[model samples]
Target chain A: MKAFTVEQGIVAPMDRANIDTDMIIPKQFLKSIKRTGFGPNLFDELRYLDVGQPGMDNSKRPLNESFVLNQPRYQGASVLLARENFGCGSSREHAPWALDDYGFRAVIAPSFADIFYNNCFKNGLLPIVLDDAIVDQLFSEVAATEGYQLTVDLSEQVVVTPGEERFAFEVDAFRKHCLLNGLDDIGLTLQEADKIKNYEQQRKAVTPWLFADV
Target chain B: MGKTLYDKLWDAHVVDTRDDGTSLLYIDRQLLHEVTSPQAFEGLRIAGRKPWRIAANLATPDHNVPTSAAERTQGINGIADPVSKIQVQTLDDNCNEFGVMQFAMGDQRQGIVHVVGPEQGATLPGMTVVCGDSHTATHGAFAALAHGIGTSEVEHVLATQCLLQRKMKNMLVQVNGKVGPGITGKDIVLHVIGVIGTAGGNGCAIEFAGEAIRDLSMEGRMSVCNMAIEAGARVGLVAVDEKTIDYLKDRPFAPKAEQWQQAVDYWRTLVSDADAQFDKVVEINASDIEPQVSWGTSPEMVVPVSGKVPALAQAKSDVQRKDWQRAYEYMGLAPEQSIESIQLDRVFIGSCTNSRIEDIRAAAAVAKGRKVASSVKQAMVVPGSGLVKAQAEAEGLHEVLLEAGFEWREPGCSMCLAMNADRLGAGEHCASTSNRNFEGRQGFGGRTHLVSPAMAAAAAIAGHFVDVRTMVEEA
Candidate 1:
């Protein structure tokens, strides 16, 4: 996990609604046990003209030049601008892992599916929800300007555009704290390990069958 | 105020709650599968952590397991794809090392985690269930507080047996009248998703209530709750009833004798109070539900089996118009085209969403005497689990399907996610019983029309969509 206070990076516009996890990282890539190396195949179907299989060298694959990330203008982009209902299908954590591995630090969208949103925080990728109108403006700005950059300050919960315009966002406080410090949730939960142990003991007495081996 | 079922389930599972409204909810059961659990297990090994309660977890490989008997003959070694084999092997190795009970590939009990859970009585009323897969909501059919979690949360639940969470708002999707003769839970849920759109249930726990829901069998109820994720709700629930108790009665893991009576007594109280409040309520008439078929990528891009592909002019906004246009391009269909006229190349009648015995029976009933159309390249039936396959075979359902030109295959997730060898080819169209019709969900560049088991079977016979109700009347 990586700590995040702020990041200033180029923005890539994904001008579509309901961009599902399948489009983010297709099911084929999910076969890997290890999480890394997903960067090369992020949005494999949309990024390449041909089918993507694991272990295929991605560089030599024909590029879908029309894809937002494949275009030269969006090269090396770290901020993703998306429409409503982004990351809408599947609870594959691979979606977030692929986004993070693909050099994206944050995603700005009007809305996101719940599991995908939760998964993003877990993987140290920031999913910022803003007003639909604001997202529209961001999308427009990124399209009109080449190499558009935005400064995302997690500490202040504001996204600052290149022109110094700032837009505020809301996030859960505890989640914010975890993001700031790059904390492992297991360690945090373990601090209250005694509480968990006691609860299990009490639960065992009430639902004995649940504790019994099958 | 009277508590809703969601409130009662949430309250019962609370180990602690902070001022921020984040509750440390104790998970009573955790279901694991190959695709998502490996990373969590890897994380555990890296951290030198052990699972909080060894007995609380149940694991199996489904997502990447080959479903063909010939390919699966060697068991894990028979899996052809090396990458997929490793994932299944990793689950086997981790479960062996961690001492978690697992139903290996060849085991009759092994199947999709959601199906295996209820069948084995690993899921029970009042339990707080979490799985790395989204369809874990299927367990909520037993009146459990169940939802999907990501790999990180999987690891967290593995280590602490608790999840850091916030309460979701309560929603009631009440279906008032009786469902039509041919309507199944698959039809009702798809109709609900069409009405709600994909994001309608976001941030809320939807309780499928009213007369119609109460009327469904335990399997039908499971089918409804299973697709709650497609409706944009992570948790979908049904109140406990006689069906729930009856389904759990003789299961291997269910409580026995006096304890069973006690459990049933407690479960009877698991329903929402008569005056319980809901933040949102959606009233639907069951008669309004028609056999459904998804025409486009998303599950919500659906219509009645007799309906037509939506015209771009019908889109409500620029975003919707663009989405509709993209769907048309990807699906290679014109606006206002009748759904029944859409030909299919293949048919798949299996998925966690509809692979239980009831679903298989419904499909078999349709395929009993009808021959699959010549235009249909292939039609396959992959039962949900080994038990389901055996039971179907005992009933001679497999013979009926085979005689009708449908391949009777072994059990696993199969083409539902296309991680295994079974998948759709580019430019091919399929009538699938699986949940999602998202682009490439079945295979890259494959177009999928989501339908019920009977509907899928009917499509295979006709080589196109047809009203299953009409077929029943003709028979």
Candidate 2:
């Protein structure tokens, strides 16, 4: 987990609505346990012309030039700008894992599927929810300007555009603390271990069958 | 004020609650499958943490299992795809190392995690169940506080035996009136989703009640609750009743005779109080539900099988019109086209939604004396589980489906997500019994039409979407 104060990077526009998790990483690429390698296969079905399998050399595969991420202008983009209902379908955390692995630090959408939004916070990925109009403005700005960049400051809860315009965003205070300190969910939950152990002890007495493992 | 079902279930599972609105909810059962658990277990290994209670976890491979008798018998060793083979092998290894009880390959207990959980009586009323898969909502039909968790939360639950969750608001989807004989729970649910749209149930825990829902079987109840996620609801449930208790009586993991009486006594109190307040409420008439067929990529793009597609001009808003236009382009169909005129390249009659014995019997009843049409390129039946397949074969359901030109394969979630070998070709159209109709769900460039098992079987013979009501069993 990397503590985040601010990130200044290029933005890539994904001009599609209702982009599902299947479109983000697809089902075939969900097999690997090692999360780092998924970067090359993010949106494999939509990114590559040829079919992708595990262990296949991605450099050998032909890239789909028509894909927005594959276009030369959006190279090394760290901010993903998109439309509404992004990351719908399957509760696979692999979707966020793929996005984070793909070097995306923040995803700005009007709305997002509930599970995907929660998964992002726990995986060191920031999913910023902005108004549809603001998202539209960001998309057009990124598309119209080459090498467009935005400065996202988590502590101040604002996004700074190239023209020094500031747009404020709301984030849960607890989540903000975790992100600022680079604390993963497990690391945060383990702080209250005694309480968890006591609860388990009491639960064993009431629901004996649950613990009997019969 | 009286308590709602959501309040009751949430209160019972609270291990602790923080000032910041997080509750450490105790999880009674954790269901695992190949696709999601491997990475969670890997996270545990890297963190040097051991699972809190191995006995409470149940694991099996379903997402990538081969659905063929030859492959099923040979087990994981016979899996050909390198990625799929590793996913299955990792689950086997993790289960072994963690000492978690798992129904291994060739075991009759092995099946889709959701289907196997209830059948084995591992899911009891008023319990808390969580799984890495979204369809885990299916367990909520038993009056449990069930919902899907991500892989990170999966690791957290594995290590702590609890989850930090915020309570969701309560909603009631009450259906009144009597359903016709041909209307199954699947029809009722699809109709409800059409009325509500995909995001209508978001961030809410819904309770399906009223006279019509109470009359459904335990299996039917599961089917109705199974697709709550499709409506974007994380949790959906029905109150426990005689039907629920009767279904749990003799199962292997259910309580013994004296304990059964005690269990039923507790379950009887799991319903919402008469004066309980719900944050949101939706009402429907059961008799109004028709056999449904989806014409587009999303589950909400549905209409009665007898109805034609709506014209783009009929769309209520510009956004809706744009979505419909995209669907029409992807599906290669025109507005106002009769659904029956659409041709099909394949028919898939199995998924977690409709792969149970009753669902299989319903399809068999339709395909008893019919042969698939020549225009249909392929038709297949993959049972939900090894136990389901065995029971279907014993009742001669397989013979009926096979004689009707359907290929009867082994049990697993084959083609539901096209993660394995069984998938649709480019631009291919299929009538599927699966819950989702997301674009590229079955395969890349494949078009899926959501249907009931009987409707899927009938479509295989007719080579298009035809009302199953007209193709009733011959007297």
Query: What is the clash count for each candidate, in the order shown?
Result: 0, 0
Report the poorest 10 consecutive residues by lDDT, candidate 2 chain A.
A205-214
**Tens digits of per-residue lDDT for model 1, B50-89:** 8888788998889989888888788999999999999999
Report the poorest 10 consecutive residues by lDDT, candidate 2 chain B.
B466-475
lDDT of 2 by residue, B1-475 (tens): 9999889999978888877787888888899998888878998999999898788899989999988777767799889787799899999999999998898788888998888999899898988999998888899889988889899889889988889788888999999988887788888899999999777787789899988899888878888898888887889999988899888889888877677787788889999999999999999999898889999877888998998888988876655788889889888888999999889999998888888888899899999989999999989998888889999999999999999899999888898898879999878999999988877789888899998888898899899999898889341
Q: Return the clash pairs for model 2, or none.
A: none
DockQ of 2: 0.59
Candidate 2 — which residues are off by over 4 angstroms? B473-475
Candidate with top TM-score is 1
Model 1: residues with Cα > 4 Å off, grouped in runs? none
- Write down the TM-score of every candidate: 0.99, 0.97
lDDT of each: 0.92, 0.87
- Per-residue lDDT tens digits of candidate 1, residues A41-159? 89899889999999998889999999988899999999998988889878999999999999999999999999999999998999999999999889889888998999999999999
